[model samples]
Target: MKILLIDNASLTPVNSALCCEPKTGEFAKELQALGNEVTMYGQIVESENIHAFNIQENGINVVGHHRRKLKIFNYILLYLLIIPQIFKSDFIYIFYPSAFKYISILCFIFNKPYGLYVRGEMGLKNGVSSFIYKKAYKVFTVTDYFTTLINSLSKSNIAETIRPMINLNEKDIMPVNKKNISGIFKVLFLARLEEDKGVKEILYAIYKLKKMDYNLKLILVGDGGYKKEAMHIIDKLDISDFVELKGAIYDIDKVKNMYLDSNVYILPTYHEGFPRTLYEAMIFGTPIITTFVGGIPYLMRDKFNCVQIKVKSVESIVNALIYSINNHEKMLDYAKNAQTTVKPIINSTRLSHAEALHNAIHNI
Candidate 1:
């Protein structure tokens, strides 16, 4: 099968770590390994239109387009450039939202089959997404909630849930040190420092914990538009000493090291489809404390694989942290269980990738 992957809107050059790119790249690699031809087209936002090669280092071809802006005229230009390439493929797989309604209509005008991967929260925006959902042949979402939402909106029975997959390996798995425990437990919050991510709530929880004389270290990773506001909250609460914002962590190895070093991971995100960070933390054997929002409950169980907290409650988080610290053995067990749960799902191997793709293809 010849597959063409389209990532037109989200192919921002600002994505240095290529957080979103890896999954699509992995899919392309898997398809190529199965003796299929795969090509990925990424659109980069730029000042002037320029063609560039984003080398597919792992058995796929990646083409990039640099456009001045995402205005209507540029979008039209992008559509014109990408439509022909998309038509050339046997199958088309679109990631995120695409100008695909226009391109897909063209493809349909020529009788083509295309698939869409909705990795973001659906139904948040109005008419635009509803139209795309209706037109797609196969719609893949990261969570069941989103799948149901898309199904309801589109009135299409073709929606399926495919959780985000990561490259996990035996080498990546460190020795499970049950005996080793942190004297001052390090709690990590690895997400964008934004209001929607609940960073303020995390800081407040830490502050409350400190008021109760709990000695804990909180590390906040990732940079976002809300850095100043989060910092102000930290200052207002006078908990700067307890909390440290480490900014955007680009290196995967460095991120893995953070996971391995920390005793517990907390993500109090207000909304998420299925966060990759949660899986990343779980795979590294760190106990997770995340809110019961979106598809989080699908992966984590209260007191089993992870501790699920309620949204926007500082007391709840502090209580969970205290409980996790007191029941060290239970926390370790939960961490181990988390690792076990995710290992089989996201192991990084050609065989596993082939199997996942085969299942998806067969089901679709």
Candidate 2:
């Protein structure tokens, strides 16, 4: 089947000697592997003398449309252009509801089948997304909480919950060390350095732990708009000796190494649709310490696969960290359990995009 993927994100050429962002690139590759002719339509900010369209790595075709100067106007123009293309495709898989709603009118007009995939929390009080939720054919979300939110917001009662597919192979999962590593416990916080991502809370927790003489090393990965603010918090707390902000790591192998070296993965995010980092941490057999927010609790069970802390509380996070360090064996058990829980769900061979596309196509 021919599938036209409309992505608002940037897409460079395959021969550009640059790798695309892992998550988006993985999904694109998956669609291509499924024998579907995948055409990616993404943003092109500046004017290029050469052609815009290019075949990316793994044989995926990408078309870059120009959007100069005016940001809102470009998006509006893209939305208008996308409507005509939607009628030509066999299936329409949209990423967010706002864009989905904008495109849904065309699908509704033409009597076409379209699926909405919500990647983050959508049902905030008085948000514009509530209207978009009501128009989708089938709503797909990454977590149970998001599924619940979609169901509550949808007036038509057409929502199906499906977990985001992670492309995990044997290489992704590190061998579990049954023997515990001694000395300072390594903690990893892998996400965008944003206030909502709980970077400040993690730093404060680290400070509290250090004062109590808990040997810990914190590695902060991923760069975001909040880097300066987060750095200021790190400096203000004076826990620079224990915490190291390794900004924007894109290499998959290096990310896995960070996970392999760490004893615990802490993500005290205030909100999320479903965090991919949690799954990445679990795949590497690292015990997780995260807040009970969004889809986290759905993927993890307290005292079973991970330890859940209260959101925005330094005290809670620190206490949880101390508990995890002292009870290292239990943490390891949880890590092992996490590996068990996530392995089957994210395994690429068993359930590929080919299968998902087949399912979507057959249903349509």
Candidate 3:
């Protein structure tokens, strides 16, 4: 089967070749490994570095298209370029809502079947979203909460929960009961450093921790638009020694090491559908400090398996960190609960997700 995956993620092309984001890129490789001809279409850097239209990336074929400055013109050109791929692919799967708009029209014009994969609920509340999801061949959402939201908002029982396609070795996963809270008080923040993700709040929280003379260290393991600003604040706050901005880690082993070493994982994002990082932290038996937003509420209750902090609140983040530190036994218990919650889903291989894709396409 020739499967075409579309995403709004930017791909940098040059001597480094085509860059695919880890989650989507790894999932595409899984599809290809399943004997399916998989090709991904993503945004290419609009620069002189433009090379071939398609490149083989980690056993998967990646097709990148350069973007136009004008937003309207960009979509027009994007649709024109993607029309050919629409016909070429046996099944079309799109991640992200922006690329989802009007692709339905192109699919209908070609009489091709297309599935929708929504990672978040950002643009899910409007009429346009309702119509699009209602018309989709299948809708794969992240959590049970989001699944219900999609069906309710669309007024159609079309959305279903899809397992986050993460491959964690069961044997390597630290048993939650064996989790240790006493150690180097290190915090891990492993997501894009965006304002919405609460990077600034976290930085301030670290500063507050320092003011109290706590020898806590923070490791930020992702980069985004706010990286420069985050760095500026780190320098401004004079907490550089306490913070390490690792910047967009691709090495799973290195990432696993960070998770294992950290006493707690924090994601004080203002919004989310369900972050896959939460599950990663859970597998490592690291206590989680996050806001109760998106799919988080469905899986985690406050002071249950995770510490729920107010969104965008530096005070909440600081207090949560302090709470995790002072209450070792309780935090360990929470980590254990989190591990039990995510174990089944985390243990499932990416093959399960790929096979589900196959099943959805073939059955549809």
Show where candidate 3 strays beyond 4 Å.
46-55, 154-157, 177-184, 347-351
Off by more than 4 A, model 2: 7-20, 42-58, 63-74, 97-101, 124-137, 144-163, 169-181, 347-349, 362-364
For every model shown, what is its TM-score relative to the native structure?
Answer: 0.74, 0.80, 0.91
Clashing pairs in 1: none
lDDT (0-100) at residue 111 of candidate 1? Answer: 66
Against the correct fold, how does model 2 do in TM-score?
0.80
Residues 1-364 of candidate 2 have per-residue lDDT tens digits of 6666654345443445223455666676777676667766656543111222344645776556666478788778877777657766777766663433466556766777766677665453344566556755566677666767778876555665554566565457766534355777888999877789988888888898889887889999877668888889888989999998887776777888888888888999998777888888888888899887767777789999999899899999988988987898898889888888887667655545446545666655
TM-score of 1: 0.74
Best by lDDT: 3
Model 2 lDDT, full chain set: 0.72
lDDT of 1 by residue, 1-364 (tens): 6677776344435334221345555666777877778777755543211112233445576566666554787767777787777767777777655454456566566666777777665343468677766777777777677778889988878787664555665456664435355567789988767788988888998999999888898999876668888889999999998997887775679888888888889988887778889878877778888898877777678998889888888778888999988888898888888878777556554345334445555433
